[model samples]
Target: MNQDRILLEETFYVLTKKNSVFRVRLTRKGLSLIKESDNQEKKQTIPTRDIIGCKCLRSRKSTTSCSCQSLPRGSLKVVEENSGEQDENDISAYLYIYAYILQNTKSGSCKRERTIITLRFRSFDKYEDNNKEAKRWRNTIKQLIKGEQAQNETPDTPIMHKINEQRKLLVLCNPKSGPGRGKAIFQDKVVPILQEAEIPYDLHITKHANYAREFVRTCNIYQWSGIVL
Candidate 1:
């Protein structure tokens, strides 16, 4: 199964060169910039395969700006601000730049172009602390991207076996016990959560007093990772 695990997440107030501020969610998938007042929700999904490089920059200067000329269609123009009265609250001394290539379909043909996205988190206190946090995030993301690239390159290689976090569970339900709501409880509450977590499970209702013990004794224990009674 191809799954993109979330390596990290951070909420940052992103400032554009245009002087507009947005609450952005930075994740392994990409950035989600939300502006409630303007009803703007911009999302940038950069696949690990697309990421080419990442870097962190610290500036002693008061102003910081970023631009992207070859961004994909529907990509938000988030980093454009004309020189104007700087807001006192706009305090970002460090910038994290991520470089990647986006594939766009133009006239039924696929085209690839390089794009750059810059983001900075709000720092209420010291500028040095902000720079350090930005650098940490930059390094972490770069390492994850590099690992993804390596995994892709060695697709045929045998992956190291690891314990599954979401393992198959055998749920033993005594439907006739406990107010006779076991079935209802599993159906109404438990099933939805299991489905949400993508957990595989098997439900077995007890038919008699000794049914559970007998089933366990004869059942193929190897098939189930764990039992939940």
Candidate 2:
């Protein structure tokens, strides 16, 4: 199997003397052998249950914090240095990290669709554990941003206020980003919040790279005050 495209718990089938039989194996890379022989060519689907075990371990959500996940480490490190310490416990600190991450990505320039945020913290003792910390921060930030703040809190309790935005939104999804889970994240998580808030927004699914740019050019910027990538 090719090392580039293997997924965990992926399977493939093989033919035998008596009849065609299903041979299952787990591939962590989501990869499976596509049999293409002179005698026969066919497509086989591997069910998650069929996998007795996986060759590759599932990636933790904290992977987003790693330098290798999408952007370079040095770049993130430089941004972190500029922002300050990568403190997971501090809300402001995590927000700065989130801003830094977005800055490194090419799509950071997309207008003010919403407050782009990142949260970081310590993970396991051995590893840097940025991803784990980032996720924890993400949850906390979302709760605050979505009007979960207490109205009658004392000075001691932190206040969570909504940041007013200036425009409608169109979220352009990149399937490749976040290991093909970007779209799912938007659908399952982002969409509901936008709807609950009565925020005017649309979802555009892209099949290839650079589709967002093309879509943006054709789209009427006036209709949507903001664009999220």
Task: Find the candidate with the highest lDDT and give its number.
Answer: 1
Instruction: Compute the lDDT of residue 152 as modeled in candidate 1.
Output: 26
Q: On residues 54-117, what C-alpha lDDT tens digit does candidate 1 reach at each position?
A: 5554332234353323334433322212234323333454454444455657577766565555
Off by over 4 Å in 1: 1-5, 15-19, 26-28, 31-40, 60-91, 148-229
Q: Write model 2 residue lDDT over 72-155, tens digit each, in one string.
A: 322333124223434232222122211111123376563322222121222344223544443443333343334343222234
The number of clashing residue pairs in each candidate reads 3, 14
In order, what lDDT does every prediction score?
Answer: 0.56, 0.41
Model 1 pairs whose backbones collide:
17-81, 18-80, 18-81
TM-score of 1: 0.43
The TM-scores, one per candidate, come to 0.43, 0.28
Off by over 4 Å in 2: 1-167
